[model samples]
Target chain A: MTEDQIIAYVDGELGPIEALRFERAMEADAALAAAVGRHRALRDRVASHFAPIAAEPVPARLAAMVDPSSNVVAFPARPRRWFDAGGRYAAIAATLVAGLVLGQVLPRGPAAPIGERNGAIMAQGGLAAALDRDLAAAPENGAYRIGVSFVSRDRRYCRTFSGNAGAGLGCHGPEGWALVRFVAGSGSEEQGAYRQAGSASADVLEAAQAMMAGDPLDADAERRARDSGWRLR
Target chain B: MSSHRVAWDETGEIIRFILKAVDGTELRTSDVTEFERALLDLLPRLRRFARALALDAADADDLCQIALERALKAEAQWEKGSRLDSWMYRIMRNCWIDEVRARKRRSETFVAEEEGLAVGEADDRRIEARVELGHVDRAMAALPPEQREVIALILVEGLAYREAAELLDLPMGTITSRLVRGRQALLEMLGEAA
Candidate 1:
């Protein structure tokens, strides 16, 4: 067998038929088996040698770049017009200011599919039903999959969801469920699979770490929240 | 309608809380914030890839930082729905090539052999393991850049052979050949170390 075939076998990249044939060849050939063993040992050593870096706290300089406060300004371009001294005019001015801010902050473009309700971007269409009805701990096969549910630091309910678009963290706010953090596909994991906490991507995990007010809601608490329309009150 | 208006009152505090939580560093653009957040999670993997490519720890981190800066500046070029990690890896590989060319222009000596195996800190008990890892690292650093990258992508980073080929803009057969030779060299060097 070629060295490429041996490496392919080690990586499990070969098809079943090819793999079966390779296995037969391996059983008969000691040198080929020894090469496979060496390759496997080398791959393991490389992975383990680098594994510790993942556990290290990402350097503060790197973390600062993603810190929401450092990177996400709410509305920096609001026009600086002075308001008149009339009470009614002040109220009108405040309303206009709110509209301007919402226009900047609310999801726009293609993301508009997730409708805006009460100033929050609610998961619409399939995502809404999944959040409203689907239990994360007991997942069902669907286009959208819910991974974990927890209360946010602000006492709002938030859950991590993934679908064809990508993975994101959506939290229930006064208006509706808002998409707070989203990462385009990393091409690491497939959607619709029942991904456990351990399998969550770094972006999903960081969003959870930043927002999780407590441990993830247990099945009983989740059901209670669902029954009560996902409301904390 | 009235409830939506009241929600604005809470928005002020929510915005303030988020800003405060991030220590008052203002997010200039939504796209930048989103991109940075996504890229932040991939740093560890990127670092590991850099470690394999650049060999020296400081050079690896430098390569990572340069690639990140380039990715952020050229964020518009990134096609949505594609794998961000793969795109970043391509940028990193380009950066390494440019660095190599620049070093050649300057006629500076390339990385010292001993400098190539610096894989972060190790404890006293794992001395034997560290030595083994050191040998592997040294062997990896000795390969030509082309062969080293194929090994890095396919062997260390776990990209499929096809994916590695596409990332390197090479044919599948070339990737297989390079990988075959690279692995043989590595095995021979490792055997000597053993």
Candidate 2:
């Protein structure tokens, strides 16, 4: 069998019985075997050339994309108008109220809570005090990173914290830094390092920004705030 | 639609799962379908496309989020036996194109190159292979949008030639020709033995 015969055989473009006959012929043909092998190798080379993508670690944010239910919330079908704006805001307020209800009413495990805690510092109690009194006392290190302390555009005092429990942002609002998000591996739960929070991780940073009051608190401001007893407004 | 009834509860559960992750909403019974199950199952592939298209992992995930939001919003339109994968692929392609176009407008100097898109997780041999793959990616990117669409449908996606041709609204010869040219270029860049 020739190279063309093998290529045609592999493509299954040949008739079924003819394909079977070719397969049988290849049993006795060493040269055909080598040729077929090369053909398969080439096909795989092409496929793998594009297929490594499947093996790469799929970023979590992408994985979080599941089809959102239409029932969740509906935005204006058309651009907002003066008349529509009021209706839209009303609808949004209603949705927020509903979300708030669900968030509050839902029973939660220690690991996963449904809604943001208001004026609550819900860290493991002993852990919280240790961080406030001890970890906060340490100087910043590039290696032992404590993310960032920023004053969000919204006047919330936000900070990224990492230690044994993992890295997450805590901010001062009606509820104080109720662990807005705990990013896995962002920090070891060792409760002792100071790492800078990445300005990436939009959801975490956005929460930080949403709670922020103005420009970020500089290192000097952070030190003074810590010195002045780290009060929450 | 019989399968709709056959797995009504299961379908509802899957819808709930997706909804819980996306937004805290409850899906009505009428909103479930086997087509959705098929679409949700393809999330990994969609993420792969996102990573391939976006420069940074963060942006890739954002693209995936947007794509998911779009797919869910348009879920009601998907009919059974209509090739859900292809429909989802079209959605992903459109999302990526829109995002790239927006980014392009924002930054005149930006170019979306495959080399920068790699996650840098592999070894030297794999890295070399990935660079070769990057060339194929560029060659595919260089084709006319129409031809590139055909290659993605028929070749990378493994769709039947006729099905792909139909999906792209092109003649069968056009798909074959585009595929041939695409494959030939890829082989040349990677070497025949590769």
Candidate 3:
């Protein structure tokens, strides 16, 4: 087969008749078969390497840009009055107030001594040790439970965790584990409860999805990340 | 079938509204609301494509942002019956090309960073296989941008030759040639790494 025919066949670009003819020729010729196999393998390898990006959560900033409520203010201030006139702005305002109130009223479990350094959340004491050494595959059944670990779109090592304090996603950088977003009163009451509960709340899940650049690291990848001190470099 | 027709009609109405808005005519709030909702649904796919086209995660997201902004501004240019996703992809490709040209004008240096694929010194075969995939990611980064875009669209994003050609606004022969060259270059890179 010519080079174009080989590429066309590998890409499934050939019509039915042509593909059948190519297949018959491959059966009769070893070199042709080898060429086709190589191209197929190359395509599969490329696909496997990049396919994880599809399962990643869309970033929050991009989502906000497309959301009508947010984009109304983004356009021109004058146009937003239309939304306000329709009462939609009022409803949105009410929701925001309710959210803020709930945020203050929610009972977050015993607070961990987590601090901030260069804008990243720095874990101290138990939280620090857990983030530094804990593996998701082998849960400690302790104060914190590690969920999915992934590489963020910014190439940072990020993981989802839940504890008495709250549930959220955090990324490890030079300073420490930066808490990207945390939702209070959403974490499992206990390790056993978390397993039974299946997953974190929708809000926490959405936060995790927004930061994930690709698929959650598999068991081996997670172990490797932990072993390397959760460093992306 | 009837639901499909309904969706098509709704899309048609939205397009008309978009055209009117583009021409500085008054638009209904509902029209803008409907368009935003549809665009929101396409975010995940657009992000995936952006990730494939860009060199790193941050750059990928920046491209997505630019593409979304352009798509919003040029809403009226989108043909009613054409695939919105494909149209968005084209906008993204053009935006990337423009950035590339601008970077070239500035004489920015491109550096090939070491692949951060190192794992603990374990002899386990599974760990080794995963590391190999990491190498593939790095190898993909080393490809030239034009060839890389072909691999991204056809192999990574699973767009067909015809669809990718249409999206890139290139002829079928050019698409096929780039795909062939990209596959060869990638295989060679992987072989060298091994």
Candidate 4:
């Protein structure tokens, strides 16, 4: 066989037919036989070189893939479960320790927004538009009127409204209308702005209530309510 | 009709058992359970493959441990009905490559740590095994990483040619040629040793 054909055979690239042809040729040629022997030896050496990996125990860290419960403690971000009161305390202590480790041991910043910008008790923006266009037009119905308003003993003006949308009070202030407080009114609360209006007591509304007693705004009183800055709640 | 009914009954019972097992655990946790089971089942195979890739027993075990950790984390991404064994081989290959890279980066000189090779060791039998293993390990480590991975999977893990090709994401011809070259290289490397 030609040297090229022998080389192919040595590399195991020969198919059955080509291999047989090469085999027959090698049988009669000593040099060709030596080349084939060398190739075989190369193959054996290669196999033995990497034949040891199949007998070791997989490491525990990797084995934890099967059982996270045993290994999860190593990961600090994951929360642990507490099955009892003691467990709960332990979990809390663990959390505090972890927090200390993270260097966040105290309350770091203002947790809630502060409220002194503009007294929202009065009408403002779309609310001011609503009050201007809609408030007095339906006063006889009393459904959306501020329940009462007057200059308070503190000498600050305020007004409270029974929201047409539900049960709650909104007050008037220099910035426009700020809702003081709201209680969720049942039934059809979803239908209008009053839904959220009475849902939570706004700081403005509470301050307005603290300023004024009963007896709501007349046209002149309402105008004054919209000009003067309401004071601290 | 009665024979068909009996076969159906057996099938129903098998399905029932599978359902109960699956239902007993959260779907995510169930996969974890299956993965752990597969790891335990594949431990011996993993060791064999590691040994083939790493020359020393301790190094091989270390490789296995790293491979197992990677496989477990990646287990969630494994699709249902995929072959876990092949998934594992790929993980092992990557881990071995990483360790090789790390060692290279550290420029760490590794002396063959087989205690059995130490001169004048008291334990003859243990030393003989260690020396033999150490020779094989040093020879394997000299091969290029690509060739070594193919050899470990095909010759050591005993994966089929097509399976190894798929696992390595290589063409069948590439796998065959690599294996052939790898085997030749291994033999040449070992033959030079005593």
Candidate 5:
């Protein structure tokens, strides 16, 4: 049997003719049989490792999303101004922003997404608010595009963003949205996604992936995070 | 009576209505039908497949959400006679590749991607099941992305070879070759055989 056929046979990928011939050869050859055994064992080992996630209870956010009832909700208008001084919230999920702003209404548009405070990089203006409340695809138009929200290995909530503010990652901590890594933005629309444009995004994503301790929050979990002011227990 | 302002919830995440229509329009569940239900039923498996692709739980679900949104939007276009699972997997895999370009990965060492999001593994049985799961998780994580994808679809998810090949748009030989490379790499990392 060819090497490919042998592997395919173990994977049950071989055609019947190929599988039959492979079996004959395997019986005659102990080393080949042993090799197949190892391959199968490894397959079983790896499959079992990942299979539990499937068995795990589906996250409520995800389950709610696919429910025909939840999926059919009206597209309430998108708010232009996410932050305002009035007692009323201008947008959905603005209640989560109350604790974030600390009762002081922040101004709009002028402040850049990245700023140096206490000699450390911090997210300013809309970027700060977006990191605190924005979902992955939500409007961060006033500042930058928030790509992915993940818990850093150190358990701090971190996010990746690109667009006018430059492509990089920032983590939320005592100092607010502290910039962990930064890459110069090309300021291109397609590149704004922090993906698929070039090696720059790959670098940023690698950093995010390295820093992430677990899966990034799905929408519901992100909402829950925002609801609780992103405090990890 | 003409206006139907959708009330935003206090938490403001779950939309409170499924078929509420505006302007006193007749409410309908026509959008859901069989497509949405089938999509919901396949969610668990799709999440597994997506997790295989995205390697992060939240990213996988986000990827899943995007794909589902697309699928629901294009429900009429789906060939109903075909397997919904395969079709949805196709959408998800394409969505993952297109949106994030989660490609260009060259790592061959474990970097700790999404570890266990164990839901009910605390019992005595799961503890036994987890004895080698960590080691296996590391071995699988050490593989190059290409090999890992094949291994995930074929060996881990148990898709038929042809199904995986067609879903990925690769030739039969190419699929087998990737399976071979992936299997050997996995075995090598696992220290089962060369």
Candidate 6:
């Protein structure tokens, strides 16, 4: 048999008959037995060389893709868009929420005008009306001061409002305007006047600028959307 | 099937025990199939095979990542009641041939830092063993890529000659001959009197 026979026999690649035949040849020739021994030694050495790699912990980047807990299809995670950063009410904490004013979001009561309907934080009474009406795009002198009106990245019409009720960003949803991001100007809206950084609406507008999908709605688009009852076009 | 998983878990018993003490890595509830769990179990072995194919840990992981993506993407193509390990091996080998191997040919560099990192916690004896391992690794690298792959399949990975041959789509004689040449070179490099 050639050297390949010795290599294959040592690696158990030989069939039963071939292995037995090779064993007989090894018994006959002492040098052949030594060659077999050498082949066995090499295979053992090399197996040891590479086997430890199997024991190393898989890298987290690679492991994350197969993690059953995660949505493996999206493991690497999509890049956050600049316009949608700290905006869009997907996950408040997941986005960069460094200095946003999220004041006691949607505190519900008989006197309070915000309520949760079917798990959605709904803007009740004047707040919802301000988000719904043409007055949202009007000048600063309106009753419920609308800082800006724009469509969110999700195509929902949203308005930043501050008044006697409270100040926050509310996006129009099926149930009504949902309080997506809140300004901490609610209960403290009386004498203390819900001022932190500056006027609540100013903070709302600034936060809205960072969080808005685009520029605040132009007067024409704002009027048209308002006339159509604030439905996304 | 759960009993089989328990058997697999036994291999990771120490790891699980440590994770429990540290409150690390709780598997969240998801619709995990036995097939998926089996694939998860094969990762370490696939990584070993990947290391045998590629140059460094990072490159091997990149190759593994590509293989995993393809494996999951074409998961429906995999046959039931067959060895998933072999199927995954085929997928990894294809990834190496198609993507990583071509990329590596353009700029291949041996990384000693990876070897140092592998044995960061090694004792003196283990350090000496690591030195020997490094020698073997260098020797394997010195081989032609073809011979190196053959050596990886037969010697390092312990595939049968026929299995290696079929997996590579080469004749058995060609595969055996390549293994013999690779082993001879490796033995000589290691200064074994073969």
Q: How displaced is residue A179 in candidate 2, in Å?
A: 35
CAPRI quality level assigned to candidate 6 from its DockQ score: incorrect
Q: How do the residues B1-194 of candidate 5 rate in per-residue lDDT, one tens digit apiece? A: 12222222211211111111101122221344466567766777878887766555576788878888878787788988778988887787778656533222311123235234221121112234445435555555555555667877887789888898898899987888877876776676668542
Each prediction's DockQ? Answer: 0.16, 0.11, 0.14, 0.12, 0.15, 0.18
Give the lowest summed-lDDT range of ten residues in model 4 chain A. A106-115
Instruction: For each candidate in turn, give its C-alpha RMSD to the true structure in angstroms.
Output: 14.6, 16.6, 22.1, 23.8, 23.7, 19.9
Q: Give the CA lDDT, 0 to 100, for residue B55 in model 4.
A: 56
Please identify model 4 stretches exceeding 4 Å from their true place. A1-233, B1-32, B108-133, B171-184, B192-194
Between which residue pairs do clashes occur in model 5? none
Candidate 2's C-alpha runs over 4 A off are A1-42, A55-58, A67-233, B1-36, B49-63, B97-148
**Model 1 C-alpha lDDT per residue in residues A187-220, reported as the tens digit of each score:** 1253222222113245566768887987999989
TM-score ranking, high to low: 1, 3, 6, 5, 4, 2
Q: C-alpha displacement of B71 in model 1, angstroms?
A: 0.7
DockQ of 5: 0.15
Q: For candidate 2, report its TM-score.
A: 0.40
- Model 6 per-residue lDDT at B68: 95
- Indicate the worst ten consecutive residues by lDDT in candidate 4 chain B: B1-10
Worst 10 residues of 2 chain A by lDDT: A73-82
lDDT of 2 by residue, B85-164 (tens): 77777787788768655544444335344333322221223234445336555444444444555555544555677677
TM-score on alpha carbons, each prediction: 0.52, 0.40, 0.50, 0.41, 0.46, 0.49
CA deviation > 4 Å runs, candidate 3: A68-233, B1-32, B108-133, B192-194
Off by over 4 Å in 5: A15-17, A68-233, B1-31, B99-133
Q: Kindly list the per-residue Cα lDDT of model 3 for residues A1-233, writing each as its tens digit.
A: 88779978988989999999999999999999988887788888777766776656566678666653332322221223233443422222222222222322222234543554443445656776777788888999677888878888889988778776456567787777766554433465443423322234454567568878979999999998887888777
| CAPRI tier for the interface of model 5 | incorrect
In angstroms, give how far residue B186 of model 2 lies from its true place.
0.7
